[model samples]
Target chain A: MRILLTSVFVDDQAKALHFYTEVLGFVKKHDVPVGEKDRWLTVVSPEEPGGTELLLEPLGHPAARTYRDALVEDGIPLAQFTVDDVWAEYERLRGLGVRFTQEPLEAGPVTTAVLDDTCGNLIQIATQPE
Target chain B: MADDLFKALADPTRRTIIDELAEQSGQTLFEICSRLSMKHRLGISRQAVSQHLAVLEAAGLVETRREGRYKFHDLNTAPLRLIVERWLVPRTSEPEENTP
Candidate 1:
């Protein structure tokens, strides 16, 4: 299936906007208004065209609270996404002051790196598809 | 929630059900069954469909709303989107709402 958009819950929109665009190299797509201060914010990859879209969702829903909390407790990534070169992304992200909880580790043909998004969750960067 | 989502998606029948829901926008259980009747493509029973819906709901991948005597099931894009965002979308800045 063609993956369209992915989303994550953010505590603050302003911080998320900067981190995604300035630090990570993702370009802003839409910051449509949802409701008083609520937005349907989204972003897209710079290299890939009409490829992956990132949705900046607001957290406060009980369901998200539980899901995110459970992920944090279990020490399991909520999910993993593929990249062209995990190490390069890792180094690049590191240069920008991104703090990673785990350094890049190789497992079989795949290599992975993880970092704290500073939003109570850990993000995994994988070089190979799992 | 990820487990629930993965479990719900593990079955081909459940995936079919979800695919149908996606195409039709949301569907009542009764309507869902009705559409599946003519096709022998389904591998499971109606009861199984209910169970799948339950799992999906728990995963935050699908939601059910009560309307009159029937319950309408709609796909929740949160988990799917979150899964995609974490991998495909790069961190622009530190994600804002960090709830401890």
Candidate 2:
């Protein structure tokens, strides 16, 4: 089976859309009304429009808050996206006032950095050996 | 306290953790684990790393800081002064009888 979609629980879908598109440079792929207060929102990389979709799920469940909070407290990222150069992306994002929990660090074959998504999640950007 | 410090420094894994922390003062547990497993080639579990951090924290060799929703671990070499005070400093301050 192909993995076409993944999700990160965001505290606010509107804010997530702005950060994912305007700041982090992801393109909006889907946006439909899910319920009274939620939307079926997703974003895809501009480079690979059809590659995969990241669902900006709402933090509707009570357990989700606890789960994400625990992970965030320890600086664990819920989602990771591959980049051309992590250091460059890190610098670019920092210029936009993005708060990084972990700066660009070269660990063995991979280099990564973690930034707060501002929607109650930490996202990781990495450059892995291909 | 001295016993705790020595015991914390006794483990190879713990020492490696200190070495990584020394390289970067403020690091998350996730970052520390990444360094140990990726950079150091250490085959260790995240829970084990957490326990190791606890030991270091008790020894006063590591300190944890809370900033907003995140918690970061920082290396503090202050407790290491005990080693110098207990042995190295005393020897240097002592009058050498052989010099007389």
Candidate 3:
């Protein structure tokens, strides 16, 4: 079996769609209305449009909210995404008014940076070691 | 399955437990608790570890068997492999040589 989808709980689906697609450069892959206010929304990396999808699931469950808040409070990233260049990505994201909890740092062979997704999640962007 | 797996992995403690099981599978609850405390310095109770294992088992990331009086847990990495093959492997392969 293959992983068709994974999800990151978001506070608002519409806000998440805007930030993930418009700012983060992912393409909207699916958006089907699921409930009265929430939809089965998902996005894919621009570079791999047909690849695995990241579902922007609603944070309506009480457990989800608690889990997300605890991670954010502890300064831990909820999810990590690989980038071609962490520094360049950091600069580009900062230019777009994105708030970063940690700036780009080279540790060992890889470089990484963490930024708030503005949807109750801290997402990490990293570059694989050469 | 995806939701359950992700939720299981969401907690750092559960992740660490999985890491331990990955390093050496077929460990009993007592062994797991001891390893967590000795190696990871996590002083979580045996009851707590059992609950975490239950979550992991429900996620299809862990399998358990009862042998006599001992219940042994083993890591089922199939789910994680599916994730890596689906998204990570493809994205990391043949990246543009120079893109800024």
Give per-candidate clash totals: 16, 0, 0
What tens digits encode model 1's per-residue C-alpha lDDT throughout A1-130? Answer: 8878888887777788888789877799888898798889888878775788888788869888787866544234544667888889898989989966445655446676666566655677777645
Task: Tell me how far the alpha carbon of residue B46 in candidate 2 is from the true structure, in angstroms, after superposition.
Answer: 1.1
Task: Say which candidate scores most in lDDT.
Answer: 2
Among residues 3 or more apart in sequence or in different chains, the pairs in candidate 3 whose N, CA or C atoms overlap within 3 Å are none
lDDT of the structure predicted as candidate 3? 0.80
Model 1, runs deviating above 4 Å:
B1-100
In angstroms, how far off is A109's CA in candidate 2? 0.8
- For model 2, residues B14-55, the per-residue Cα lDDT tens digits are 999999999998999999999998899999999999999999
lDDT of 1: 0.68
Worst 10 residues of 2 chain A by lDDT: A121-130
Q: TM-score of predicted model 1?
A: 0.52
What's the true lDDT of residue B36 in model 2? 92
Poorest 10 consecutive residues by lDDT, candidate 3 chain B: B91-100
lDDT tens per residue, model 3, A20-55: 999999999999998688899999998998899999
lDDT of each: 0.68, 0.93, 0.80
